[model samples]
Target: MKLSHKLYPFQNSDPTRKSLGDIIILHGLFGSSKNWVTVARFLSNFGSVYTVDQRNHGDSPHSEEHSIRLMSEDLEEFIFDHKIQNPVLLGHSMGGLVAMYFDLTHPGILKKLIIQDIAPRSYPFAYDKEIQSMSFALDGFTSRTEIDSEMAKYVTDSFIRQFLQMSLDRNEDGTYRWKLNVDGLNHARRVFDDVFTFEKTSETPTLFLLGGESEYIRDSDFGVMDHFFKNNHKIKIAGGGHYIHFTHQTEYLEILNQELSFHS
Candidate 1:
């Protein structure tokens, strides 16, 4: 599958400046490349930044099948198709899981790996309510407010409701429809809770960015992280939650730039 992407070319035009190679960013579930526009623009100063929409999300083609392995394969194809070399692969939440799987299966393909706010272990929580909300909204709403109202019943967080609303697409008749493949994602809900396992530890340099307010990465998960990534570094954003990049943009970017500079 050829994933859809938005590229931000290097901003600096000075010939004397050095290139930091490619930086590929993958968005989380129900997210599109648009979510990372600000980050991509900032990272563009270092290298060409490619914000990709994983399968079933954003402008990417939909599939009945969705899993970490399949998404990893899609990333592989996207990387090869665009001839991206030694890209600094970065992923957030669900996308981070895909990045880890890709590194585990196809080792040495990336310059460095960055996993944001997600651990290698399975999540206990399910997205049933969120899926239901999306399904209800897909029936077509007269206005974005009505959609938000309907989503609020399932998703309590205003920020998350607003985030999910970003995936809305207005139809010809002016009714709003979701851009994501809702049914496909609903079917694969269990996959999200599936644990990631590997026989051999990966040597690729990895950085794990944790959110202090988020329960996604627990203290116990550090052992799993160490077992998988032998050359891994962990950093925590004190005030950030699961969406650290959005909540702590300045701090997140500063840490990301510092880490990327180490390899550059």
Candidate 2:
């Protein structure tokens, strides 16, 4: 499947500056390329950045099947189709799983791998309320405020509600509808409970950016991470939550820049 993507070309004023190759960023569930526009623009100084929307999300073609394997395959196809050479791949949340699966299945295809706020282990189902709320919202709302109020019943976090709001689109008739494939995603929710098995370790240099306040990547998962990623380093952004890039943009960008510079 050809994924929908937006590219930010390197735009450094210095003519003497060399290109830093390609940087591909994958957003999390219910997220589109639009979520990474700020980060993409910032990374554009170093390399061309491509923010891609995985299947069943954004403007990408929706499929009944949605899993880490399929998404990784989509990423591989996108890379090959675009002729991206050893690009630096960054994945957040659900996207992180896709990146890990891709590297594990097709090692060395990526120059560097960055996994944000997710571990390889299976996670407990935590999106039931969110999915239910999204399903309700899909019926169409008169206003964004009304839909936000409905979502707030299930999701108390204002930040999460705002993030989910990005998936909404206003119809031509003025009704608000979810742009995401809600039914498809609902059917594929089982994928979240699936674990990534690692029979062999990947040699690709990887950076795991964890959030200090997030439970996604806990110390308990460090052993599994070490077994899977042989050439890996981890950094925790203090007080940052699952959405570290948004909650701690300065620290996140600083760490990303330093890591990419070192790898380059």
Best by the lDDT measure: 2
Clashing pairs in 2: none
Tens digits of per-residue lDDT for model 1, 1-264: 988899999877677767789999999998999899999998887899999999999999999999888999899899889999989999999999999989988888889999999888787537788787888734646788988888889899899888887888898988777889989998886666664754867999999999987878778989999989999989999977999899899999999889876766
Q: How well does candidate 1 score on lDDT at residue 72?
A: 92
Q: lDDT of each structure?
A: 0.87, 0.88
Stretches off by above 4 angstroms in model 1 are 13-15, 137-140, 193-195
**Highest TM-score, which number?**
2
Query: Model 1: C-alpha RMSD to truth?
Result: 1.5
Q: TM-score, each model?
A: 0.95, 0.96
Could you tell me how far off, in angstroms, the CA of residue 173 lies in candidate 1 after the best superposition?
2.8
